[model samples]
Target: MNNPFPYSEDNKRYYTWSHYLKTKYKNKVFKVALNANFTCPNRDGTCGVGGCTFCSSYGSGDTIEDKFEPLDVQYESNLKIMQHKWPKGNAIAYFQAYTNTYGSVKQVSEMLKPFLFKDEIVAISLATRADCLSDEMIEYLDFVSRKKDIWIELGLQTTNDKIAKSLNRGHDYQCFLETVERLSKTNLKICVHLMNSLPGESKEDMIQNAYKVGQLPIHAIKIHMLYILKDTVLGKSYLQHPFPMLDKDDYIDVVVSQLEVLPKHIIIQRLTGDGMRGEQIGSEWMFKKTIVLNDIDKAMVARNTWQGKVLETK
Candidate 1:
């Protein structure tokens, strides 16, 4: 089994650090999830009150309150962790956890000033909602892309409008297309966040959604299995019905089929993301993160399959 892509050492689709970065710098790049302290439109009453049911008030990822902490401190901590772990890698400042592009242009500028001249930070990846990227935000992103590489991660849990509404996503499918169109005009790379095993979603529905995403102007893809975490609407609902979630085998088939239709050029950012176990409810297997991802990789390799192997032209 021989696949040139570092990701496919065994003639299968697997995540490898070398193939993952695909960088020429001969080093690793770190991601620092910046607490941008930005608020969402949903929380501001412009769209809705409580944000997406699955989103914690602080947004996802490890978060710390204390707005007083200087941005450099946070960046330093993240860089330290990466350096300690890899020792030879560089770093990238990830404005994660919330709508990084929500604030005013001036505010965003100020928030990112600390890393402006940091050579170790080679790129910046922003995690944000499709609707939150305003014209000014685009301008900022455009400006940043010229100076440094940029990646914008848009959260598109499912293409199903009903599920999006149930999750209180605040934006619609049209909005997602519009956002991508707008961002396409920029030089930044766009990565999409797709969730599987979401409530009210069937196998056919998930496949359709993945195909739809493959048609978008996306540079990368990140997939995660939905988990009903504690203190969320999803968690409460799961307790009531306990509808089946994708187990290990189910997930492998779903992922392979989805990948069969996914564009191969699109780097697979992640196959799954494990939410904090203490806060996660139901689907305990999610806690076995490494084993699950490894199993998926092994299965795909054994079958000699890559994403988008199966597609139907409509």
Candidate 2:
């Protein structure tokens, strides 16, 4: 009763990405969220128009470096900043904006090639939509897996069809599952992105989405809390109607419930996401990342629960 959860190696509760990387590579690992000037298929009209309801003008890459500079220049410059902060740590070249696979196989190859041989960079992360990945993209990614570490992040904010439709995500649950199956043929690690406090999602719906992802073949997951930003579709809508949102404590309870169902082997890539200062309009409490994270740790300890403590999904 006096001890914290017993799921992860560090014994905090969940299987964190930091612990996984540090133990596997024997050093600290930081992901450099980079931009490649890519665009989403939805905004381009391949799937839909106007992009996702909540997507920022930066295409969800607000924190990434300026895209005007060449990819190598950005990587090298950012590498220096990271190196100074943690002298012994390594970095992951993360292509974070838009649908990274929207480009041709050759274009995608060029974007990733610069980091393949970089000694200081240990891995590469590519974020994209499930509907945007073509067969050629998979072929090229598979070829790279022989030598370079690759992690593919797919955004599937919510499994609920109505919520996805409302968000204009432009992809269904089946599409996401199919893409994961195809990508599994390669050695690249897979991570699914889920969001809490969506427009119409219930507490149980969030729990169900977590269980669904855990049953899949993914190696990691990123749980983002929905925060309405200014001047976007979601922001405007929030101003008009102001849908119900999760308070800090309610969000903590929902997240802990998810952790109970996810398999211990799966890595928790993110617990909450941040919005650009002066841009986000809702869920203001999320700005304090440390408080949200600390509360999660405390909640798990008080409840005597841990990641995958239930060990059953479906």
Candidate 3:
């Protein structure tokens, strides 16, 4: 069958990160997840406490193999492991742990300066919150982006402010919009993270989130199903009184619908998340990452739909 999507090298119906990197850089590219030893405002008593209800004790950095090591050591160790697969590939230094931009301008600069000059490092990705970004921090990041590709990853798990408050997210949807507006004037690329199946949200609510953000000035997005892990508030609560969650087939359906609404030019960084084994308490279906992604592909093909299908009609 012919692939209707114009941006894909393979038969994928949506724009993929691999296609974006291969077309731009002409080589394999991967992210080396690093723990920058930063803490969030909510976790450190600046706003609230205990972090997000779903965040684990590692602040969602459980996948970082050498998280406890120094930043340089952590980057070198992980990059070497990834290069064993793609021997000549370049890397994006991903600050995957807590709020990477929660510190002062000097602290953030010190953390990123070493990696900026490395030849093998092609870009830097920092996962941060909207309320944490100060004017000075934004200026510094914008300045550094002139030297190297800078990606500021903001987590807006859901658009519903009520749901956000229930999870103790610290900030609301308005904060995210303001932050994106500020970053839009800079050279930095913005990637927003959205999670489906958050507590108290419906399938329509999830699709609406895609519709709204797809109209923004975002360069990319990462969507994943929420997985409850042990040692977290949500996990402990689920153990006592479980809430309804989406099954595999329903999750694929929602993901395909999300893609249909999203613009084709925006890169789909990730469609599914890798839940750390032995720690995840519910949503066990996310363990089969490849199967979930393949099923989403099949669903899109079966419906004869490509990305931006709805937008084209409008």
* Predicted structure with the largest lDDT when compared to the true one: 3
lDDT of 3 at 145: 93
Residue range 151-220, candidate 1, lDDT tens digits:
8999988988999998988989999999999999889889899999987898888888888998888888
2-96: candidate 2 lDDT, tens digit per residue: 44444356657888888889888999899887889889978988888888999987888887665568887777777778888998888999988
Number of the predicted model whose TM-score against the real structure is largest: 3
Q: What is the full ranking by TM-score, best candidate first? A: 3, 2, 1
The per-residue C-alpha lDDT of model 3 at residue 309 equals: 94
Tens-digit per-residue lDDT, 1-314, candidate 3: 78889985777999999999999888999999999989888888888999999998788899998899999999999999999999999999999999999888999999999999999888999999999888789999999998789999998999999999888889999999999999999999999999999989899999999989999999999999999988899899999989989999999999999998999989999999856899888677898898898999999999999899989999
lDDT of 3 at 273: 88
Candidate 1 structure lDDT: 0.77
- What ranges in model 3 sit over 4 Å off? none
lDDT, model 3, position 75: 90
Alpha-carbon error at 177 in model 3, in Å?
A: 0.4
Better of 1 and 3 by lDDT: 3
